[model samples]
Target: MKKRLIYGWLLAGVTFASSCTKNFDEVNTDPYKATSENFNPNFLMSQAQIQFSQTGYDQLLFQSMWVQSLASTFDYYANGDKYVLRGSGTGYYSRTWNRGYGALTLVDEMKNLVQGKTQYSNLDACGTILRVMFIQRITDLHGDVPYSQEGQAKSGNVAPVFDKQQDIYKAMLSQLDAATAALDLNKDKPSSDLFYGGDISKWKRLGYSLMLKAAMRLTKVDAATAKTYAEKAYAAGTMTSVADNAKVLTDNANGNSNSNSDALLVADDFREVRWGKTLIDIMKTSNDPRISAVAEVSAGTGKAANEDRATPGVNTASLQIGMPNGYDLNGGATDISKAPNYPGTSPANPAVPNDAPAPVGKYSRPRLTVYDDRSGVNMLYTYGESELLLAEAAVRGWNTGSAATHYANALAADIRSLAQMNATPQAVVSDNDIASYVSRNPLNTANTTALQQINTEYYVVTSTTFNFNETFANWRRSGYPVLTPVTYPGQYITGSIPRRMPYPITLPQTNGANYQAAVANQGPDNFATRVWWDKQ
Candidate 1:
């Protein structure tokens, strides 16, 4: 019953095209089986748009734990929860690499199909924007990646050299700038454009917004360039409101639902995930209304005799607690009952018998009604994120806007966007609450704490939504709201939180020379080595 994007119809068209093409190929007997010219560019664009937003099962397993927004109570999830990167844990690295490059290949095919075609100039621009988006994610994960020589297997360069992160950033910014400027509204647009629905104006906003994000990322490392692009992006019209958010919609149907919902539905292990103590503590301290919107009360109240019980799954801001990271049943205690501060107060534990419920469900899980809802929107970029980044730009003396106004606007947009996740009345943040939160948490004018304040708010905003990758990246760049590194017994990287993910294990065997070259140029192929932009 949910509103579906037009992808289904487009996919059917692609299928029909494929079936019809077989007859033509059989009759012609051309040396090459098929060419890019044989396919509709819209179909390629549709696939790229969908694939670009597809984070799949890896995000819930790895990113959520890495950012400390979610944690696991069982040994099964200890690999990720405790930073143990062995056998199964290493799968996260491989899955992300595969998905990212797989999507980029489709974008490359689309680019090849539309390149140098005067009539499809706008489509070409769209392809470039998508390429930048896809490649940025890859470079962010691993410092040096195959950018220039990527997807060039047909050109006979199977072993492409790795591009440095700095070079990649420069190229991405240039591409975005050119692509955004080249998007002509009068030109024909793709009918299957899922993100913008063929609206060139919104596509332009998304392109500039991505530019803003790339520039802000270099704040610590390259202040001058960061300032330059941030100003240019703002002038070119970055996302200004929730209406301009670049989100992909779902229909709540099989094979068409939100990726997060799909993962949660099929994987029983994912159900073990609950809110992390670090995030919950901050939200509870600030009395953030988003906590109730994002998380639910423990299903089972571990209370003894004569205890008053609170209703399960109630949206009481005070009753929601989170499980701590980096402890398993075998590590210290027999179970949740024996663990110190079993479902401790602050966000109070449920009122059920101590031994009655499983430890995993004994604490708060993410709000299933919203987050796990199949019809939910997968937010890629948003006005809230842009405003927060701009707020930081203002703090850095960039000619964007007043820090106070941007900060207030960021808070308001974030609250309003959460309401759009579902029609739950409790999730809808009131204007009074928005105004009050903004007023209370005004940007710290003092230079010493201004950047910290802005980045910390960025963390809070990204946590409620499914922006864990950005949350981790910003944390590394800004180092705000200082997080404690978990020192679990069998942790792989010790003494600090991860700076970047390890390269996929298959890289050495698949592309040994290039893999070694990248490892040598960028620091050792390990989690502790900082990426180029993460100078802080």
Candidate 2:
């Protein structure tokens, strides 16, 4: 009876195995997962674009306030406003590093998908330009970063050594030169491009424009290299007009909302964050038309109403008062109430029940219609920025162009660029108004302050467009606008503004040897240390 039972079980097992083996490949394959062979590589371009463009709290928590473009009294923003650690401060420090690398990884994969394919030459070249762009930003933010072995984890390079910033810049310029030259307008364009909708001509412009910016960054440390690349970029053709600006409009319906808009719409942030006095004062001093286009005073009274994102604010340029940085609503000595030129608290709202006065209600905030639009455009690189860089290059005796002409072009281009920020065109400065404003603010190349004037306008243009990273970087490099370091009691760094952001706090543990080596060479893994280009 035992032998009969064993024979029966063996027969049943054989029958089951034979049945399962009939469709083994079909059963194991995942239909939902896209393979390289099946997936369209163009889709990754959109992901890369959105990911890099959506900086969110990464820039806001540090560069924005550190550069004094926007100021916030909220605890989280103390990371920048007061140079003190607050909620998720460590996490915020890692944000750019993590996000930037993540974006680079996507671009790397996208490139690999079409690396040797002749039909996808444009995609490959565009990916190369994007790779250079991301590497430039990463090295700029942190002194040394993984470049040669970056995004090679799948190929057994789990621990990539950090490359020196100087080497990285050299490599970036070389890569940009080849990539921009490789861009053939006849080739197939990236169908999923977020900027310019797959226009190869515009991509060519963006590539050269980015090259110009990267080259200009080396002015302080490597003027010869700067001049070489700047002239090359100018000859290759940088952005010539606002139409060549590289910007991406967020699609809220598709769950790709503008990160800045989302961050600003947070009630606490929307309530307390205001235009910095340094920024507003400069605009007001220059009689800048952007003052009215960018800033607004809260409409209703009390904290409840002031925090309301639905209601529009008063955008009269004269009434828009900027709040000073390093001050808060903590009811301490550094409270907003104790601030100089304090506009006083907003009147209590009768509609609300026992609401407190908004500490920053009277201070200028970013206009809701302009800044809080979920579907707003993210201005990446602009024609204005390119022209400004060329203007500086010309001033330094580089064979770029006339300094006065480039500077004036930048001024006009920047004003026109504002209208592109909103989805429905909120900050519309008319051509007549833009031309009039540009005429009034001439770039006197003869003055000793030529460089200062050019860069200060660069500061204002970048700050108003909410590109705080560039604003901070340019401020450090050019030393324009002359921001006073915030001397809050428990600040992290003293005596000067942060030259570079600290590496991710988790770096030492995750990549110990590489992280230590970087610190050893780059100095201390702190904010006070300068990158290669930010020369003393």
Q: List, residue by residue over 1-536, the lDDT tens digit for candidate 1.
A: 23344777778889988888759766567756567667777787878777767675556676677778778755556656778754477777877677778888888887888877887888889888988888887788778999989999988988889999999999999999999999999999867887888899989999999999999889878999999999999998998788888777766665767777677555444446678888888888877878777887544343321021223355677777777787665535534445557764222245432434345555677776777777777777789889988888988788998888988898889888887665343357788888888788888878658887788878887777777777788888888768888777667788888888889998899899999988888888988899999965
For model 2, the local distance difference test gives 0.90
Residues 58-156, model 2: lDDT tens digits: 898899999999998888899999999888787888888888899999999999999678988999999998898777777888889999999999899
Point out where model 2 deviates above 4 Å.
1-33
* Per-candidate TM-score against the hidden true structure: 0.87, 0.95
How many residue pairs collide in each prediction? Answer: 5, 0
Query: How displaced is residue 160 in candidate 1, in Å?
Result: 1.4
lDDT of each: 0.78, 0.90
Alpha-carbon deviation at 151 in model 1, angstroms: 1.2
Highest lDDT, which number?
A: 2
